[model samples]
Target: MSFLGFQLRWNSVLLGALVTAAVLNDVPPSYEALVVLAPVIWADRTTLTWVRIRRR
Candidate 1:
């Protein structure tokens, strides 16, 4: 799989786990931050991918 594919799969799994943890556990920030952080990680990955491609 490509980097993107791996990231996508990993992201999906992480998102699900985060959501589940947020609902099941008592830690507020953990789940809330994970919910918020998913997009940031995705955007950063996208930007990095493009930057790497441009350098090639």
Candidate 2:
């Protein structure tokens, strides 16, 4: 599936599923995965901010 112009890849989907499962099971995600995800999360937030500014 695509969001905006970004294509959601299988690994991204799978990782999201796994993360959800972990949360439901009351398990914390590993620091390594968090580190890997940090930039992507930041970029998403930054992009959202940019889009909001552009829309106004």
RMSD of each: 8.7, 7.4
Cα distance off (Å), candidate 2, residue 17: 3.4
lDDT of 1 by residue, 1-56 (tens): 23432234455556667668877886554666767876865754322342223433
Compute the lDDT of residue 26 as modeled in candidate 2: 98
Q: Which stretches of model 1 miss by more than 4 angstroms?
A: 1-8, 31-36, 40-56
Candidate 2 displacement at residue 22 in angstroms: 2.3
lDDT of 1 at 11: 54
Q: Candidate 2, after superposition: displacement of residue 36 in Å?
A: 0.1
Error of 1 at 13 (Å): 0.2
Q: Which residue pairs overlap in candidate 1's backbone? A: none
> Which ten-residue region of model 1 has the weakest summed lDDT?
46-55
Pairs in clash, predicted candidate 2: none
